[model samples]
Structure formats: structure tokens, C-alpha cells
Target chain A: MKAFYRWTRDLHLWLGLFLSPFLVVYAVSTILINHNATPGRDAPEETSGPVLVVVPDEEDRIRLGRDIIAQLGITGELGGVRRMPAQQKIVIPVNVPGKRQVVTVDTTTSLATVATKSPGFLSGLVYLHFAPGQHLVGISGNWFWMRLWHWMADATVYVVLFLTASGVYLWTVLKAERKVGLICLGAGAVSFVVLVCGLLF
Target chain B: MARRGLTYWNRKLHIYLGLYFLLFLWLFAVSGLILNNTHWTFVKSKPVDVRSEEPVTTPAATDDFGMAQDVMRQLDISGEIHAVNRPRPKPPHDLFFSVVRAQYFTFVQVNFDEGVANVRVRKWGFWSGFARLHTVASMSTRGQNMFRDWWMTKVWSVCVDALAIGVLAMLCGGIYMWWQIKPKRRVGIVCLSLGCVSCALFVIGLRALFT
Candidate 1:
């Protein structure tokens, strides 16, 4: 019994020491998130940019589309390209969106122009979810790390559960147990059961 | 009189807040369980499809930037724009535009000439709640961050620190209770050790993975 108690004491102390920083972060973050309620409400707005086109001639838009298809390394199927000379526009179809880039080249001059979207917070969040690469800003949506934190938090929960269970165990079968201790055990058990059911179901 | 009164009030406030803190312990327990067995519980996710159309415009600072704006206008979506990178080694960088218009965020990539566009949206929910608690991102709020110059964020940080202390205290209390009533039987020790070992193994195994 004493050995078990010592083990619990050691386990509790060391784990607490190791997880202190995490606990503080978790607790405070919880309260903050709870109060704030909405992440997107405070999140920044989306940004936009212009489109530049480079082409040898207006008819060369198809060849330009093929070049882009090859350069972007489209693994998926490629669709045909259409040129709207009246609008000075070129549209290409592909399995994936934005797999094609239009380089509008001046027919008379060698001037060329390109255009793309402005990276925004929302986009960063998506990248973090799907393909988290070199982008540093997407850390917020990276659940792999967050999942690890939850794992620690889960361990702490088990410790608490053990404490509750042991408390009940010591109360019931152990000698010199008082009626008040038994009552506390019953109450704790009922309370814990209710909480578990409330949350799980 | 005022000094004594203030001290008394402080003690009372501590006791009151301590009780409130107990509520979090239960929350930690219940939420932790749900999070761990996410597979068993059904957490539904919905898909959002956005469509829009906008007239083509003139060239801007960079080819990527010009295309990105046109696409967002076409989709009838708005977001905050981040960096515009055109790496030499990689394909001509499309303008990467990010927008945090709601509880979620969207990323849009546009090629030059408004010819190609890729837009993705990310929404936050069940998992994010657990994550928000983990990072202490909001701990930097005004009052909380004060523990460190950034008081708001520090509020949760301080609470986490306190939880560690509380766990230590609870361990001591558990030990005191056990010592007061020693269990002689092997069964008791076995039961107790089983739970403790599982938890210990969980923590150690996790730490090992990261290290």
C-alpha cells in the first residue's frame, strides 16, 4: 500500500513538473477560445492581385497553355484551351484548378505579364490542413502538433481518473474507513459517471 | 484595518477561484476522453462550395497578384492577402491569397493572366476547440499576459502552472489518505499500480516519440 502510494506520489510529481507549461497553456487557451467563440470573426480578410499575360501572339495562347501545363507538371488530365481575342483572354480546362498559368506576351513588344492570388490567412489555414509545407504561418491549423498536446492532456485525464478510482477503492475496501469517506466516494463516483455520460453520449 | 481587510479578501477570492478551477479539471477529463476516442464519436464536417464571377481587369504589380485578385472577385469571396512569392527554382509562383472571413480561412492561388485559379477553405470545429486549449494562443490577452508583460495569454499560462501545482497537491493529499489507512492486501497495490503504470507509460511513450 505504501509502495503504491509512493508510486502515485512520484508519478504525480514528475508528470506535473513535466506538464506544467503545457497545462498553463492549455487552460488559458481554453478560456480564451471559449470567450472569443469565433476564430474567423477576428481573422484577417482575403487579398487579391492582378493578372498578367505573356503571349507571342493572340493565337499562341494555346501553345502558351500547353507550355504552362508542362511547366506546372500537371499529374492530372489536361483540358483544351480557348482564346477570347475580343476580351484578350485565354481559358484552359484541367482536372485541377489553377494548374494552368497564362503568360500574356505582347504581339508587337517582348513584354510579358503574370498574375496570381495573394496568400491570405484563410488560404494559409487550408494549406496547413492539406499540405503543410514551408509556409510558416499555417501553424495555427496544424493539428498534428495540437493532437500531440491533446494526447498529453489525455494522459493527465487518466491520472485524474486513477486518482478518483483509487480514492473510491481506498474508501470502500480499506480498513478504518469512515462513513463520511464512503459518502464522498459515492458522490464522486456519481458525479464522474454523470460527467462521462454527459460528455460521451 | 485596510491591510488586514485586503489580505482577508485575497484569501477569500483565492478560495472562490480555487473552487471554480475545480470545474476545469472535470472539463479537462471529459473533453480529453472525447478527443482521444474521436473515432468512436461521430463528428460531422460539412463542405462549402463558393462560386462567383467578375470581369477581367488590368495587370498589377506582379502577374501572380493580378490573377489572384481576379479569381477572388469571380468567386465573390474576400480575404486578407499575404506574401507574393515568385521563386526562381519553382514554377512561376502564383499569387497566394489568404482570407479569414469567418471562423474558417480560405487560400486562393491564381496564375498570371487570370487563366488559372485554385481556392481552398478551412473551417474550425471540435478538434480546433481542443487545439485552442493546447496552444495558449489567446493567453496573450491584456490581463492574462501581465504575468509576463503580455498578461492576457499568461492568464491561462498561470492557470496551467497552477494546475501542475494542484496536481502535486492532490498527489500529496492522496498519499496522506493512503498512509492514514494502509492497505495490507496485495490486490490493492496491484490495482493502484496498474492505473499508474498505464498513465506513466502513456506519457513516457509520447515524450520518446517527440524527442
Candidate 2:
């Protein structure tokens, strides 16, 4: 029993120490999301002056959109392309963490305009929470960090689960703490059930 | 005496809150993983039970949310209302709102011309439902009047706030507890530093280059 307790304790501590920073990122993002912290005051910088790109002859909207951004000398995850066949124009959305660019292209004249918005670093961290999430699932994140951030996010969650389980075991080993811990555990269980059942039924 | 007592309670709260929040932490955390790993083939299951029901009687409510609820109650359906498509000016134009849940999702499209509500339900898998829990009251979900239309959404929102705050509190308590262990302090410092530096590099480093 002693050996097991010590092992669990060490596992919780060492893993918690490493995982806590990533957990902080999740926590901050959660707070930002729950509070609706997407402040609209900060305007986008459209000053990527005289954007010139070679309009490729590709017929596919996604490929054409990709080719335009490649020639324009900017990078991020490309979003859905809005095509205006009559006007021969396609609007593309590209995003990284701190910045999002809306690249509008004119196929006929090969003219392009880029409007870049820095949603702030805090916002960048918050954006990581829902990157190629459910909306655009089953696809790779278009940018490097967006893809890497999801990997980190996945690790944090798995650790949190392990830490929670180990925490309960460690608490159980302490006879004095058991009573209060049970009360807390019971209270949490009730809250979770009531809240979920309330939503579902 | 009070200061000392407060410190003691803080430790107790940390343990207890961590305990109380254990299941919630697990729920959100696991749900988070499900949502984050949508690239997995098994997780990419499509919505099942796709069928439209016969037209039902419509209701009269002034507000968008209230009207949605009236439509839901009349149809014997219940869930948070989302993806509201209000009376578009085009052919087959009608007011529509989705009744969203973990397993069952129903769409209510009110056709005033025929004076009926078209109910389309697409039952999703458990994975999709679980993932929906994490995003229940998130900014992604649409609401008006602070989710006043859905009592459950309001309740869920409060829980989300409490859980986030509780986690932060537990982290502080854990750090405090770590500080008291003289022997483990050095290694803990190294562990924490590596974690913090790595986090800063990804979050702050990427932004620095773009700026």
C-alpha cells in the first residue's frame, strides 16, 4: 500500500509539474471563451501594400485559393473560398494564432488585397482551444503552430484525466481527509448529473 | 489567528474543490479530447436518423428565442436552440432553429405559408454528443438575452465559469503545497520551468515573429 501510494504521488507530481503550463493555456482560453472576450476595438491592418500575385489557371477553388496565397508571400491555414463567378473574384480567409488574413483576389486582373487582424496574443492562445475543431474536423490544421498546439492541447487533457484519477486515490489513502473528500466528491457528482440531465431531458 | 485559519481553509478548499470538481474536470477534459481529435476515423462518424416529420402546428412568440421555445414545446421536443435561420427572403423561405443535444438533434423550420412546422431530426453518435458538452455554452453556440431562452444553457454557463475558477484555485493550492516540500523543491522547479518555457515559446514565440 505504501509503495503504491508513493508511486501514485510521484506520478501525479512529476506529470502535473510538466502539464500545468499547457493546462494554464487551456484555462485562460476557457475563461476568454466563457466571458466573450473577443474585443472588437482592435482593427485589422490591411497595409500589406500593393499585393501582387500570379493568378494560377487552376479551376478548383481550393487549389486556386492556395496558389494565390502562395504567390502573395503570406502563410496561414486557408479557410473556405467564396467565389464570385460573374465578377471573377474569390475571397480567401487565412489564419494563424495572433493574426487572421482575409485575402481577396481578382482573377481577371491578378490583383489581390490582404486585410490582416491581430486579435492579440491572449486571443491567439484562446483561438487554440477550437482550432480545426468540430466545424472543420477530419482535416489537418493549415498552419504549423495550429497543428502543434492541438497536440499539446491533447496531451494536457490526457494528463488532467490521469491527475484526477490519481488525486482521488491519494486522497483515499489519508483516513482523515476521506470524509471531507467524499463530501466534495459526492457534491461534484450531484452537480454534474443534475446539470447534464437538465440539458438532455 | 484568523490569518492562519484562512491559510488552513485555503488548503482544505484546494483539496475539497479539487475533489468536488474531479468529475467535472474529467467530463470537460475527456470531451475536450474528443473534440480535439476529430481527425480520427472512428471519431468522424456522421449523423444518423436523418428524416423529416410531418408538419405540426406553429406558435406565436414576439422574440426569436421565445418563438423557438414555443415551436419546440408544441412539437414535443426539447434541447438548446442553435443555428437560427430567420425568415430568409427567398423561395421556400421560413423561420428555422435547431434543437441540439448529445444524441438527438432536431431542426424546426416553420413554414407560415402552409401554417406548419417541419421537424427534421439527425441523431448523432455518442462521440459527437460528448464533444457537444464542452461547447454547450461556448461562444460558438448562439443565444440571446444571456441564454435566458434556455434554462439549462444558463445553468451550464454558470458551471463552466465555476469549473474554470475552481481549476485555477486548485493550481494555486498545488503550487503552495509543492513549495513546502524542501527535498522536492529543486526538481519541481526544473519541471515547472521546462513546462512554462515551452508554453511561452509556442504561445508567445509565434506571435513575436508575426508582429
Best of the candidates, lDDT: 2
Q: For each candidate, what's the DockQ?
A: 0.05, 0.62
Across all candidates, what is each one's fraction of true contacts kept? 0.07, 0.63
Model 2, residue A71: C-alpha shift (Å) = 4.4
Q: Chain B TM-score, candidate 1?
A: 0.42
* lDDT tens digits by residue: candidate 2, A1-201: 889888899878877887777777778888778876764337557656456688777777667777888887777677777788898888888877767888888768768988888877787777677765667553346566667777787888888988998998888887988988898899999989988777654
Question: Per-residue alpha-carbon lDDT of model 2 for B1-211, expressed as tens digits?
Answer: 9867866787788789989998889989888887777767776678876666556554577766667777777777877676666444235646778777656778777876776776778877777776778887774343443443467777788888888888888887788777767888988998889999888877777767644
Highest DockQ model number: 2
Best by TM-score: 2
Candidate 1: Cα lDDT at B197: 54
Model 1 chain A worst lDDT run, 10 consecutive residues: A126-135
Which portions of model 2 miss their true places by more than 4 Å? Answer: A56-73, A81-86, B1-7, B50-65, B83-95, B111-115, B139-148
Cα RMSD, each candidate: 18.5, 3.1
How many clashing residue pairs appear in each of the predictions shown?
70, 0
